[model samples]
Target chain A: MATFIDGFLWYFALAVFVIGVSGNLVTIILASRKVDLSVPRDSAFSGALRTLFSRFLPDQHMLSRIGIQVVAGYMFHLGLFILLFFAAPHVAFLEENILGFGWTAAPHWLFIVASQFAFLGIIMLWLYRMTNSVSRLISKLDDHVATILTFLVMLSGCLALLESFETLRLLHRFLVELLLIYFPFSRLMHAFTFVPSRLFTGAWFGRRGVDS
Target chain B: MSERLERGLSKLRSQIDPKVKSFFSSCVHCGICAESCLFFTETRDPRYTPIYKTEPLRKVWQQEYTFWGKLASKLGIAAPIAEQDLADWEELVYDGCSMCGRCSMVCPMGIDIAQIIFKVKTGLSAAGFSPPDLAETTQRAVDIGSPMGVKLPALQAQIGHIEEEINLKIPVDVEGSEYMALLSSMEIMYFPEYISALAKIFHQAGVSWTLCSDAFEATNSGLQIGNTEVAGVLVERIVAGAEKLKVKNVISPECGHAYTAIRWEGPNFIGRPYSFKVVHILELLDELLQSGRLKTTGKESSRLTFHDPCSIVRRGGVETQPRHILNAIAENAVEMTEHGAMNWCCGGGGGVSGNERAEPLKLKVFNRKKSQLEELDVETIVTSCSNCRLVIEDGLEANDMEINIVGLTEMLADHLVVDNSQ
Candidate 1:
């Protein structure tokens, strides 16, 4: 059971995630190419570059209105990013199994702090999604599944922190496998798709000489 | 499935370009767009959320395009876009939305919510679910010369009045002119002073401009109704007129959507570039001022603020021109808390002002602008769009706010320096 879970299922999840993500992205890119015949007043490439980073900071006028989302969203994504690549066990695992090389792991205290931020932010955002009228109205089954799955993955990873028990490690691996399998089919795709999305919209506004 | 539902689904499917696909894939359901929308902010209703308003189009995209959605639909596990869904969304897309694009700016994903809503409008229009008022107006715009049913004779009469009052020719159908100007029916019917202002400004500047008798009406109800065929036809009328007169440039009058229709969406609608350049009147006036051709006299002594119409400032890229015109004329000009490209809509654009059924909701959403005005505590409000001017006037009156509303063009014309040498 241990070998199957560790070897077969992990490889299966990875294959599915890679192929599914690439397939969906290819399909999106191939959907339809819209050509603008109108004269452009600005360069689309510069606008695309600008928006890719600029959107990380919310507009000043909108800060008061969207302070919570901005704060929580940034915390969640930044924490997840740090823990995913820089955690001690994650870096060791990536060096051995995935990339065959890894950078310096974060300090133990940093790891604990990042996990706390990730857990807090993810929970807050998920709760907000369920309670907020606008999100409640627009969110579907996929969104909830994605959020719950992410929560489980994070929780299992926390339980495996000691790494003394093989069962806890297997549990974290199992939940991560589930997440990998579900990522491409769910709104988790936003993690990768937002770049192109921002670029497309930015280029459109850029063409009109509007910095959006 | 019903034929109407099928047609609507097809239209929605056709609209799922790469951009729409990217937008749907990237949206995390953050609900930030809700706060940006005046309807949701004013009413606290989730249905008015900008992204939520595109549910019909989103469903169609999912069912027809996505893998899981396709399997679910094939297994009868997921519901297809139904006629009832389109029927339910008609009010949300038409009456509840102004397509103001404020939500677009606030979207962390950079999703153009207003553009998506416009695509939703196309599907709703195809399904015959558009409001009867908008439908009737579109029909009138296509059959008659104008949405307000202003005929050539009516325009000629208005021209006669302006001519008699200003002692200017108000030249019509003059071939080989430098510029051919188009008028919104609102300007001709309710605000003929716009034309008078133009006449005075043009005479003072010594610019060669003519009014095309063939295509004087600028507002394209087809665009307002979200019908491409009708919009193309309306655009073709202006193209034909410009070609016949051989004008160098066509000036869209001080109506917000009219400027968008002609300047931005016109070429795409007609499937070709115009022989004559399309310029907003403000753009033209700014250019004249920059060239020292158009000069202004004494500034107004009252405290005034400028209302940035959504289509012009936000969507049309005429953000700085209006301010230049306003600053040149007003002695003490103040900006609303949110002005310029990020300004809140007057709650009457995107055909809401034309829809009689949306009047109350429109007034409710006007509270956003009302609060902005109350915060500024200004007496006179100056805006460039005639639709905004009229709608803001109505909202002010309903609330019994003793505020004066004036058009920037008329205001500028009043301040134009009398060039005796010219």
Candidate 2:
């Protein structure tokens, strides 16, 4: 069971993740946009590039209004990013199974802090989504599924942190594989889609010379 | 599904371009956009949330585009969009939203919420779910040269009145003129002073401008009603006029959507780059001031605030020009706490003013602007868009607030240096 979970299940999840994400991206690219023939007042390229990064921080007017989402969203994203690439176990897994090259993993202490941040961020965001009228109304089953799935993955990863329990590690690996397979289909696609989303909106606003 | 629902769904599907796909994919529905929307902020109604307003389109995209959505639909697990859905969304997209683009600015995913809502509007409009008032007005626009039914004769009469009052010829169809000007029906019928202001300012600045007898009406009821075909026809009319007159620049009058329609979306609507460049009235005035052609003599002593029209300033990107012109005219000009690009809409734009069905909701949402005004306690408010000026005036009257509203061009015309050489 361990061998099948570690080998075939893992590779299958990776294949599904890659194929599904690539398919989604191709579908998006194939959905052609109407060419804007309007005379541009500013460079759409610069506007797209600026918005791709600038949206990381909310504007002053929005900052106070969306304080909770801004802070919690950042905490979750930054924490997950740190954990996904920099944690010791993830680095080792990537080195052995995916990258074929290894880099120095973050120290154990940083991993613990990142995991805590991720856990707290996801919890607060979910709580807020369930409570806020707007969020509650707009959120779909996909959101809750994405959040709960992510929380389970993180929880299992933390439980597996002991390194002495092989069962705990396998459980973590299973949840991670499930998450990887689900990533492309769920709201988790936001991790990749946010770039093009910002780019298109930025270009639209940019063409009109608005700093959005 | 009913035939109307099918047609609406087809239009919604067609609107799912790469931008919409990407925007929908990126949205996690955190609902931060609600705070940025005046409708939601004022009403505290979750349905008014900017993203929620796009539910019709989202439903179509989900059922037809996404993998699981396709599977669920194929399996008959997902509910198909009904005619009722379009009916329900008409008010949400038309009445509740101003298409102000404020929600678009603050979206973390950078989803253009207002743009998507516009798409939803297109679907509703095609489905025959639009308000009757907007429908009648749009028909009037297509049939009678103006949304307010201001015909060429009416404009000519107004021109005569303005010429007699200002003692200057408002040029009509003068070939080889440097610029051709367009006026909103509201400006011509309700505020003929706008024409007087334009003539005086142009005369003082020594600018060669003409009014096209064929395309004098600038307000696009087609755009307001979310029918791009009608919008395209209206734009083509102006293009024909401008091309015939051989003008170098076409000046959009002091109206919000008119500037957006002419200056920005006009070329796109017609699917061709314009031969004559489109310029907003404020942009022209700013250029004149910068070039030392138009100069102000004195300033207004009253404390005035500039209400940045959403379509002109935020969506249209003529932010600083209004401030520059306003500062030149007013001694104690104050800005609302949320002025400029982030300024709130007066709840009258995006055709809400024309939709009589939306009046009560429109006035209710005006509380957002009322609070912005109360924060500053300014005596007068100056804005560029005639629609915004009228709406704000109506809002003030409804709230029993004693404040004055003036068009920026008319106000600036009052301060012109008075070129005696003419």
What does candidate 1's lDDT look like per residue over B1-422, in tens digits? 88988888878888888889889989998999999999999999889999999998888878877777999999999966779999999999999999899988878888888999999999999989999999998999989979999999999998898899888889999999999999999999999999999999999888999999899999999898889889999999999999999999999999999988988898999898777788899999999888989989999889889999999988878889888988898889999988887899999999999999999999999999999999999989999999999999999999999999999999999998886664
Query: Best by DockQ, which number?
Result: 2
Global local distance difference test of model 1: 0.90
Model 1's DockQ?
0.74
- lDDT for residue B194 in candidate 2, whole number 0-100: 92
Worst 10 residues of 1 chain B by lDDT: B413-422
Complex DockQ, candidate 2: 0.81
lDDT of 2 by residue, A1-212 (tens): 89998999999999999999988877776666788888888989988988888888888877887889988888888889888899888888789877899889989888888888888889999999999988999999999998999999888888887565899899889998999999999889988888888999899888889988
TM-score of model 1 (CA atoms)? 0.98
Each model's TM-score, in the order given? Answer: 0.98, 0.98
